[model samples]
Target: SADETLAHLQAALKRRRRLSDQAQMLVRKAMAYIHSHYTHPLTRQDIAHYVGMSEDYLTHCFRQELGTTPVEYLNRYRVLQARHLLAESDKSITNIALEVGFSSSSYFSRVFRKEVGQSPEEYRRLKQSSVR
Candidate 1:
């Protein structure tokens, strides 16, 4: 009876490890897809389809592996690029927002503020002042 219980536990552990590995691989593929398509307007469904899984499953993998949702990850990447363009180029805030894949400057501002503790305009000004 004890031997049977031990064998069952081992099999369950092996199955869990295999599933974890599979989920990690899926997350990696999803990240790659995000990287390549971050500049385009995308949805969770699109990412899920790209990774050959359901939307819920993809979201779970992202959360489990990266501690973030796919949308947050994409938004962060866009914001990172926007910060660079904001600091280095003379592009208008709206143009920079569009270039960074946000559908509207207003949404971009909200997301940027949430992540950076400031608006995009304020960030650009700060960077400029620091450089000067």
Candidate 2:
């Protein structure tokens, strides 16, 4: 009974190890693109091309590993950067939007709300309030 239990545990652990390894490789490539060019109006197609896969394939891989598409990931990342600028920089929201790859402030506000549950202005208000 002890030997069987040990074997089962070992098998489970091995499966988890293999899955994590594969997931890490997928995320590593995705993040490489995100970090290097988050400011450059990158697209899912660009990431797919960089990784030598079709856009659909890259989307599937990203969803399997990160539970989201690359575009969603990048959008959230941009919103995060916008949050920082809102809190720390004198830049206007429009300027911050452009800085973070959003082509328009209105569009950035839309996506920011979708990802962050609030408009960028509201996020900044909350952040500023918390700091006081």
Candidate 3:
């Protein structure tokens, strides 16, 4: 009886592992879609539709895989792009913000500061000065 119970547990564990792997793949697909479209206006609903999952389930899967919401991921991606633009381009902060899909310069600055520990202008100055 103990051996039978152990076999049942092993089978259940294997099924769970397989399902977890599938869920992880779906989350990765969602992430890939987000990365490709990060410069566009996107919402969780849109991501959910693209991933063919309900919004709640998508959120659960994303959080399970990435430990952050999709919106947070998108915002972080935008901030990263803004950082690159800040360091390499002479574009104004507002333009960079818009280019990176932030709705407003102020919002972009706020998010950038929250994510990067500096305003875009300060970041640019620091990075540019280091190059010379």
Candidate 4:
């Protein structure tokens, strides 16, 4: 009986390992898809469609794998790109927001402050002052 129980546990462990590997691969694929399409408006539905899964399932899977929802990940990525543009380009804040795929400049400002602890203008000013 002990040997049989050990064998069953080993088999179950193997199955879990296989599923974990698959989830890892799917997360990687979803991240790659986000990196490529983040410049455009994206939704959880869009990511699910690209990954060939339902939105609910993709959300659960992505959250489990990455500890954040896909939408949140996209927003963070957008903010990162916006930071670069803000520091280097003379583009308007609204333009930078739109270029980074935010739907509205106010929304961009809100999210940017949330993520960076500063508004885009403040960030740009700080960066420019430091460079001089």
lDDT of each: 0.82, 0.77, 0.81, 0.80
In the range 1-132, model 1's lDDT, one tens digit per residue, is: 234234433544554453477777777777778778877898999999998999988887777656679899789878988998999999999999998899999999999999999999999999999999
| lDDT tens readout by residue for model 4, 12-70 | 44543433666656666777888788889899988888888888878887666555688
Top TM-score model = 1
What TM-scores do the predictions have? 0.84, 0.80, 0.83, 0.83
**Where is the poorest 10-residue window by lDDT in model 1?**
1-10
Which residue pairs collide, candidate 4?
none
Top lDDT: which candidate number? 1
Better of 1 and 4 by TM-score: 1
* Model 3 stretches with alpha carbons more than 4 Å out: 1-19
Candidate that beats the other on lDDT, 2 or 3, i.e. the better one: 3
List residue ranges in candidate 1 displaced over 4 A. 1-19
